[model samples]
Target: MTEQIPVQPVRQVHLLLVDDHPLVRDGLRARLETIASIRIAGEAGTAEEALAIAASAPVDLILMDINLGTGNGISLTARFKTEYPHIAVIMLSMHEKTEYVNQSIQAGARAYVLKDAPAVEIIEAIDTVIAGGTYFSSGLNRQTASSDAGQLLTQREQSILKCIATGKSNKHIARELGLSVRTVETHRLNIKRKLNIEGQADLIRYALSNVIV
Candidate 1:
């Protein structure tokens, strides 16, 4: 006599897609569905919708766009990590700027993939993030490495420099970035020390010349 055993199906990785574009979402859904162990748990065209779906459903990961209509994904990622620390997030963006990548990482994204990246790279990012690893697209890594500004400045410093380059006052930069004016002044002082700029004019000139947009 022989006993028969049933084999259990492998558990799929449930994912949430958050992007403002319906076509992008549809294309992502089709591509992700081809993978055997990945499943789309939900789709959201805005931050509000994404938050609502996450509260109701069991999502293992979120593939979020950098720009979600009027809402930004970097801020949303920080909120999600603060509220639901267990869920992982992978940022999908067209922007390959090191400042954006650094900000996303600081906000708790497990991976960053460019929108134009091949499907295989995106899949690799998903798998790596799911396995509790950090992943950045090869192009982004190369850009980060080749840019001396990226290597020198912290994310906040880069942001402040950008504001300065745009002729924003310390108070304005502080208000826009949600920091106190004193803190902005301190950052400016630090930036000057690091970059060896002796005066306001020099700082602004350096910022305008060095800051990436």
Candidate 2:
């Protein structure tokens, strides 16, 4: 038999944490340090520091806060993306306001994650965005589920939402769509969260009401 080549990860992602609060940065650094495929290249407490670090280091992605003291995170995102289109950014904030979400997208951020989100969701957002996919924190307005709301959900997410509307079980969805059960569950949860629906019944109602038939 021929020798099989080993697979590679998303290029040993290098991340720059940009938050004004030192405690927040320390907490995020501690949590992110556990991931073997990612490196915390630098930490910044202001826009100037972030820009300086970005210029000097090999940063692949940046986790930017919405409020960075005198440096507005959204403004910084716009500037960074305009200057370095190759660098990806994820906005972190405590608010899930639709205005903020849309602003982030307009400013060139590929993902928006909530600061209070579980570590798993945070890691998931990082992984998704670095892989050239968009990720938004759950509990954002449902308008994002459609074109009118910045078309937040990925194509896969849209497909899974249809499956959910069809009343298919997660196991059935996995078998029909050739996805893992866990993957289906994750997508399902994300759908509910994105739609800001707390109950399965509400999720189905919203899906059906939105003509997701």
Which one wins on lDDT?
Answer: 1
Worst 10 residues of 2 by lDDT: 144-153
Which whole-number lDDT from 0 to 100 does residue 47 have in model 2?
90
Q: lDDT tens digits, residues 1-213, model 2?
A: 999999786457899999999999999999998889889999999999999998999999999999987979999999999888899999989867777777887789888888988888889988888766677777455564333322555578788877877888889999999999999988877665445557788877866766447
Error of 2 at 106 (Å): 0.4
- Clashes by residue pair, model 2: none
- Lowest summed lDDT window (length 10), candidate 1: 142-151
Clashing pairs in 1: none
- lDDT per residue as tens, model 1, 18-133: 99999999999999998889989999999999999989999999999999878999999999999989899999999977788777877988777889999999999898778765
* Steric collisions counted per model: 0, 0
What TM-score, over all chains together, does every model reach?
0.66, 0.68
lDDT by candidate, in order shown = 0.84, 0.81
CA deviation > 4 Å runs, candidate 2: 1-10, 141-213
